[model samples]
Target: MTITHTKAMRKDNTLLAITHLSQLLHYVTGFGGFIVPLILWLASKNDVEGMDEHGKSIINFQLSMLLYILISIPAILLFGLGILSLIFVGILGFVLPIVNAVKAANGEAPSQFLTIRFIG
Candidate 1:
């Protein structure tokens, strides 16, 4: 590939990886889970090809996870099952983003399971 092509590919890969990994913002900002990814995706989606799709996926997954957490709150009254669901959600939230980030770095599309399509 030409140097220009390589550079562009590198940029795309970086942006895609950021899109996936930005979810970690939740740990720092308490609500950065959606905000950080949304900002990154919005800022880079047009500049980097495929970023729009990846951004949408990330945002949708975050939203879905939030919904799941909200639902789990009520389940807490039912023998504390909500606690288990929250734990599972926490694990998935931490793991899936890393997995997707790796996929992005490898120049593959980010595919998230248990995501709801809120933006698209």
Candidate 2:
């Protein structure tokens, strides 16, 4: 017979909010936005009350923004419309994480605007 000990999950609004805001790492260091939160989430999802949901939202938003930016690159040829999309993506990427960070701090579900359900 074998017994396993599992850590109990707990509610931590501060950690949640920080995870949401960590997406900004991409802007500050040109990377780590996804990596940081991803590591945090994977490390604590089972130990944190809302880490799974919030983490997924963050990942989805990051991925969607990346896809939009990638598409916008070649779109620079289409009369510069890609420029507009790129700007929009940049603004959205910067804004949504902040908004969702506030929400996460308040124990509200993080918003996944324009996010594609890639993980589930």
Candidate 3:
């Protein structure tokens, strides 16, 4: 009886781990396309513990999208200035997410500026 129980527990744990990995897999496998929570829902329907790294990475990924949108506004101010401004922000956006994705894949929490807001 004890041996069977232990095996079942291990199976459950493995299932949970796979689920967590799948949630954050977007950071590793794509151009931040799976950065949204919708993709992470494969593992847990409610929430999964010990996966803050993935959440932080996705948050940073979303912030990069915001940077792209913001730069487009300034890019409209002047043709050359807009192009230069976008190029700068766009580069930062690309680099930051890639770094964060690596950190996330390694199960490390990374700090991303302005991405996490204190609601309380």
Candidate 4:
């Protein structure tokens, strides 16, 4: 690739990585998980070639996790199974985003297992 192409690719990769990692903002803002990613995606998706796909994947994963947690809430009455599910969900929520971010940085598409495509 030409120098300009390579530079643009690097920039896109960085933006995509940020889109994936922005989910961690939730820990600080209490609700930035979705908001941060959404904003990043909206701002860059049109400009970055692969950003639309990456953005959708991140959003879908977040929404899927939210749905899982909501479902687990009622399972609290089922012998405390909800607590276990919640813990598992929390761990996945923390790990998957980081993994995806790394993949994006490497110029690889992120595949979020168990994610429901809510934005596709």
Can you give the TM-score per candidate against the true fold? 0.86, 0.93, 0.48, 0.88
* Clashes, model 3: 1
Across 7-34, the per-residue lDDT of candidate 3 in tens digits comes to: 2111123333343344344446665344
The candidate 1 region of ten consecutive residues with least summed lDDT is 2-11
Question: Candidate 2 — which residues are off by over 4 angstroms?
Answer: 1-6
Model 4 stretches astray by more than 4 angstroms: 1-11
Indicate the worst ten consecutive residues by lDDT in candidate 2. Answer: 111-120
- The lDDT for every candidate, in the order shown, is 0.86, 0.93, 0.48, 0.87
Q: Which clashing pairs does model 4 show?
A: none
Ranking by lDDT: 2, 4, 1, 3
**Candidate 3 has what TM-score?**
0.48
Candidate 3: Cα lDDT at 42: 34
Q: Return whichever of 1 and 3 wins on TM-score.
A: 1
lDDT of 1 by residue, 3-115 (tens): 55443522578778877888988876777778888888888776787888889889889989999999999999999999999999999999999999998889787776899
How far residue 18's Cα lies from its native spot in candidate 1, in Å, is 1.6
Return the clash pairs for model 2, or none: none
